[model samples]
Target: MNIAVIGLGLIGGSLIRALAARGHRVLGFDADPAVRATARDAAARMPATGRWQVTATIRDVAADADLVVLAVPLPALHNVLDALVASGFHGLITDVTSVKGQVRDAVATRLTGAANPVAGFVGGHPMAGREASGFASGDAALFTGCAWVLCLDEGVGLDDWLTVAELITELGARVVPATTEEHDRAVAAISHVPHLMASALAANAAEDLLALTLAAGSFRDGTRVAATRPELVAAMCGGNAEAVKLALAHVIQRLDGAMQALEERDPVKAVRAWAAEGHATRGAWPPDPGRPEEVPAHVETLLRLGRAGGWVTTVAPDRRTVTGFLPVSNA
Candidate 1:
């Protein structure tokens, strides 16, 4: 397979290595010359069997490619898509943007007006990354055993979705199908909010040198994500603003409860119970039972419902049905 990856940063560079390792011809592109040089150096170090090259421009990368993976940040995605459309390179397109809705909208708007729209564009977010950035930090193993969320909408063809899924699986990641809205909301709660909390903790502690010196494993673990690239963090949390706002509101409400509980007659019991709930919730996360051959039919149905302004919950392990609660607006 001929794969082209734009942006050549951590995710893009990693994809180049991973796809090349799988015997796919990978051409990488980055706006920054330094990044391109770094990727070229990295490619040179890889085994001779892996076909990898760094391209000078997006058009060069897109030319005759079977798949084009956009590993650029959210802010740059639409512009890149516009460039691709202008260049008249039509092929399957996928992205590693953390937020999906915006990207999907951009693709739809751009391609709808293009002289020749690309073969397809699928919004994807790999549930994998690090506090690091740039091509120098690229690692083929970064996505191994991670959940790669694929956002499907009316515009996506089933075959294109499957092709992207197969590529993700080849890179050792599970392909979890989701709607753009669902993907944004879920990540806001699980990923974006956590990063915000981590940044908050780190900023608060930084004011006190004594507190910083006293910080241990818990603080270190809690604030690790605070070190992530500011531009990347801004693109993610900002791109999914509404969802992140809602998630942050819920987080604030929970914190308010904890704060109020501390003033109760029996503070220890109140705080302990609150803490226990989180502990239990974390402990109950289902273990990844290796990737399924096909995402369950019910899961796809849930994604469809999610697109129509509803919440879907998977029923207990009967593994056959999903329940959706529609929003009042939809109802």
Candidate 2:
């Protein structure tokens, strides 16, 4: 496939490497010249077998491509799609935006105008990333062993869906279908809300140097994702407001129950019951009655972060449960 990848950041760079490795021609485009340079330099870090190209303008890069993978920030997706439509470029379009409902609505409004109707736009979110951002930090293997969600519309043909699935599969990911509403709700509960909690916990802990000094693995582990790129997170939360609000409400309910348990001073049994129930809810996850695959490993981590307000794990691979914090949630 001839593919044009916009954004050239973590997700885009990783996709470039994956597509090129599979012998597909990939053209990279980014607003920042430095990022374009970084994408070119990535070939040395993660060498690819097929030809790769980079450009500054989205039009030049996407003009003749068979597929366009928009890996830009959530807010930028609609504008780019509008430009693509205006330029009379039609292709199978997909995106790596975290929140899909808003993107879907935006495309419906902008690309489906009487002037140009978008016939092939699919929303996707690769449930894989790191605290690091930008092209420099993107790893070609970032999506490896991860789950990638693709929200398909009836307009998208099976061949187009399979093309995107094959690209993701070559990147070492399994593809799952979700509706825009389903994708937004799932990400709000699993991804966006947890990021807020991580940032809050980390901020509270940052106040005292002495406390931070005494902080061992627990504090470090708990706050690890707090280091995520703040701007991107902020945009994601703002874009998916209602769903994230619902997720936060759910989190508050769990926290309220834990607080009630603590107030009664029956910490032992109370915490145990809380952990058990929370773990069970997560353990039985996938909860997506449609996806046949098991929940990914990071799902447990996200659940742990949401339930405990910080990272806490005790169960080891040796099969023994530790006495202190909590057993690792099926890690």
Candidate 3:
């Protein structure tokens, strides 16, 4: 696959290396000269089985690219899309942005008065990252075994979605199909809210020197993502603010239940009751996906699989079917 990845931050740089390592011709561009220079210097020293280079311009990156992966932050997505449109290059476009709805809307905005608004745009969010940022933190294996979402929203071409999914599966990530709304809401509950909780917990603990000094496995494990760059966390969480707000409120309600229980007459029993719900939930750290089945290559079926917490491990080359696994849905 001939590919171009814009933004040489942690995700973009990692994507570039991953694709290039897999023998795909990848062209990378970063708005910052320092980042481009860093990648260029690394390209000189690091030997890979495949080919990739740092381009000076977005237009140049798009020129030979069959698929363009925008790895920019949410705020810069529209501008980068504008540049892609201005470059007069029209092909498959996907993104690694954490939020999905905004990307879907941004592409839709540009596609007004078109024959097919959602034909080329396949909203994507790889459920993978590290606390660190920049090219120095690039990891070719970052996405290994992660859930990479490819939004199967209405009007998205199955072929386009499959192309993106195939690439993701090649990177050793499970491709999960989902609607834009579903992806946003689910991620808000899982990814966005956790970041907020981690940050808040770390910040509150910082006020007490004794707490910081006494912090151990529990605090370190819980607050790990608090080590992430605030700007990056803000961009992701803010991009899906409405969904995050709802998820955050839900979490608050749960905490309130536990807090109120602490004041009950039988505090021990009340607390135990509150903790049981969480204990049961977390005890199922991961549900068993029994086996892979061939699902018909259709949007509705794919989305259903995703909504049920399933993922496609492989896609047939002919696009007739996808090999996927789905957890048993109680609902």
Highest lDDT: give the candidate number.
3
Q: What is the TM-score of each candidate against the true structure?
A: 0.86, 0.79, 0.93
Please say which candidate is ahead in lDDT: 2 or 3.
3
Candidate 3 deviant stretches above 4 angstroms = 46-49, 111-119, 328-331
For each candidate, the alpha-carbon lDDT, in order, equals 0.78, 0.72, 0.88
For model 1, residues 249-318, the per-residue Cα lDDT tens digits are 9999999999988999999999998888777667655432422222243546647654543432222234
**Most accurate candidate by TM-score:** 3
User: What order do you get sorting by TM-score, best first?
Assistant: 3, 1, 2
Model 2 lDDT tens row, 1-331: 7899988888888788778877888899987898888777766555547547897788788888888888899867767876677667667788899988887777777666567755577778888877677887776688875667766555555445555655675676745555677678888988899889989888997779999889889778777778887887899899999999999999999999888888767788888888797788767654332312222223333233323322112222332221112223342
Error of 3 at 74 (Å): 1.4
TM-score for predicted model 2 compared with the true structure: 0.79
- Please give the RMSD of candidate 3 to the true structure: 2.4
Instruction: List clashing residue pairs in candidate 1.
Output: none
Candidate 2: segments with Cα more than 4 A from true spot: 41-49, 153-159, 280-331
The 10-residue segment of model 3 with minimum total lDDT is 110-119
